[model samples]
Target: MVVAEVPKLASAAEYFFKMGVEGKRFRPTVILLMASALNVNISKPAPEGVVDMFSTELRTRLQSIAEITEMIHVASLLHDDVLDDADTRRGIGSLNLVMGNKISVLAGDFLLSRACITLASLKNTEVVSLIATAVEHLVTGETMQMSSSAEQRRSMDYYLQKTYYKTASLISNSCKSIALLTGQTAEVAMLAYEYGKNLGLAFQLIDDVLDFTGTSSSLGKGSLSDIRHGIVTAPILYAMEEFPELQSVVDRGLDNPHNVDLALEYLGKSHGIQRTRELAAKHASLASAAIDSFPENNDEDVQRSRRALIELTHRVINRTK
Candidate 1:
């Protein structure tokens, strides 16, 4: 019943200006703003004696984990730009494009060093092992993606599995860390992991959809990079089934000899985009459902913040920017 709006983050360029950087290495600089915002939310206090009782033995441990997590996230952006062969990230030139791959690689390594240092300082053997395992999964996911074959590309399951390991693993790991840090029960941790895993899957799928459907200018990169890159996004994948005749055309690249009008016609007639949005919404709701085990209170703002988190999920799917 509450009519609400998603928060508007400043454009990536605006974010850089806000962060006070102007160099060509604006991708990392811009990501730093978003990373900082994400970390700030993770660092927030829960409630009153919630901290005292909740602090337990994991307080410092969680702090170190959070720092390391942020470092890794920051590092990954530098690596992602190189992998994507992207010139611009976050509406600014990618670090590799601006500073050369060597410097960009070194910078990314430095961030990894920071991640390790913080993790070591956490002094939790189990947590370190968990993170190390997550990294392994990350590498495996990347390897699978790099080695993708034409036959693999033909299957939707391939992409979904790739996304699960590549994107969802780290997200799920983060939730596990949080649950462990908070001394939550195994049941609670399971619930949290389901939320994170589903959220991550939805996030990546919608990202692929947006590559075809979004305004490139708002997305900060040219749209349809997915098509140009030969990656079949969810919309196109779904549309292929709905508009069977478009298959041969899609194989040749979304270029379609028939041109834009035909392309739009197929896209408009297909239910793929609409169904994909529903799928994203379902995951977002599942994410919200994870709150069931959390200590609930009558504080309206806490509820609002929780709702805001879910809204943020929807925003990522719906946003043009």
Candidate 2:
């Protein structure tokens, strides 16, 4: 493990921030790709006096945003692990499990603090606001998940709204930030947001499906972890729709080990997984369509990035982990 150089919390925070365990790094990739895709010279610059809007300085700032997004993502992971009492992440023991909840929580806060400092360094009020709001959405989503009644959980709308806040908000906002930094037109910025939002939703939906179909070794965590924690995800929600009796099991809570098995049985019998995958595919298509709407650019880099973004949607839907 590469230990972090944090002043006080280095030992604890290192588990996530510096541990060599790498995640997909999906958010940063999308942000950087958005930067490239929107860098076409046709759009008017947001600021005056710059011949090259996407100049070196601006590129550096975009890189910072990518780093900041990753920091926020890791911090959320740390905090979520504490909240979920999770014991594994990235195929390794979770930070909370290794360092205790107090340290893990503090480490997450530390990462957020650093991310905020970097965000402030950008000195763009609108970008700051967008990212800050994303953080708020994260908290709000987690709270909703923790406090929702069984009735609320049964509603697909409620689940999707919560999903947006928890998963899609950060990605969508960060992509918007990228476009805004490049001074892309308002329409293009919105397209970037749409791309990120749909992609994020698709990504999460696949993750939810993987929870049921993936193995512990492949998923880097135990299969069915969400249901084990009584977190009703898309598959369960769809399964409940078909097997109404499953709603009673969820209503009574999955704390009973038997209920957990019974719930899995119902899910296996229903087309929940298939429906969830279809929904994911639908969102992935929307994401691709959003990229298709971007103003056509002759720049080879822009075209390549655009194609990659569309291809990324396919990758997100088909990924097993």
Candidate 3:
């Protein structure tokens, strides 16, 4: 990985890519798959009729993008763990817990700086802007979550918008960067962005449901952590819709176990979990539809990547962790 190219970042790189303790490299995998799916022969035919959909130069650059996206994602996780005062992640002690918040925060900043260097090396101004905007949205989303009022928390629109900023923006923009780097048209780039946006939303929505349904051991973190943090997610919001009285309990704050239990009881009685799953399913469908809109490709590699991208939506919805 290019992360190892700089000898000075060895420690942070090792932490991010720890052997036998890796989290699912979801963002990089998606970005790489999107790159392959969009590798259509736009300019000219290959010399010997072999399907060389991308030149080595372009492929290397795209790989750099994959690395950059993953770096940014891991950096965000590091910062988020500190912000949430998390104890465990990926079934192990969180970076902040293991190395202290100051070191973890500094490590996150280091990763972001390295990611910027890699991104600037790509030299694609539009792609640079797209990715930079995603970073900006990350801060915006975090602030929105931290400062949301009672009324704002209850509004479905507000929740969805914040969800997009926090979770979907990076995925959507990165996917579009993949398309743009491959010289795709504006129409094709939008399709890529739409697919990423929907897939990301579905992924996060399922995460919200899993926090309720999954055990701490299976989830690699405490169940009901969101409620304990007083962060209302889709399931809780939907429950509030069905049972208005639950809002009073939420408004009272979930800082205490009593209110958390009450909220969970109301959620269990309502169709909140089911409804949240349904919403995730809807976004998964939309993501698949976006892939369907891509131009037809006869190349085997392109076709395989396209199918995998569509299949990914289903996996994101059905995954237990």
lDDT of all predictions: 0.61, 0.88, 0.87
By lDDT, the best candidate is 2
Per-residue lDDT of model 2, residues 1-321, tens digit only? 123576558766666656655387788888888888886322234467656644756887888888889888888999999999888897889988887899889888887888998999999999999999999999999999999987898999999999999999999999999999888889988999999999999999999999999999999889988888888999999999899999998888898899999999999999999999999999999999999999877888889889999999999999988
Candidate 2 RMSD to the real structure = 3.9
Q: Report the lDDT tens digits of candidate 3 across residue range 1-321.
A: 435454544565457567423468888888889988886422333678676545756877787877888878888888899999998887888877877888778778888888999899999999999999999999899999999999998888998999999999998999999899989999999999999999999999999999999999989889988899999999999999999999999999999889999999999999999999999999999999998999987888888889999999999999998
Between prediction 2 and prediction 3, which has the larger lDDT?
Answer: 2
Runs off by more than 4 Å, candidate 2: 1-8, 40-54
Regions more than 4 Å wrong, model 1: 1-60, 245-268, 293-305
How many residue pairs of model 2 clash at the backbone? 0
In order of appearance, the predictions have TM-scores of 0.74, 0.93, 0.93
Model 1, span 188-223: residue lDDT tens: 667656756777777777877787677867677887
Which of candidates 1 and 2 reaches a greater lDDT?
Answer: 2
State the displacement of the C-alpha of residue 147, model 3, in Å, after optimal TM-score superposition. 0.9
In Å, residue 116's CA in model 1 sits off its true spot by 1.8
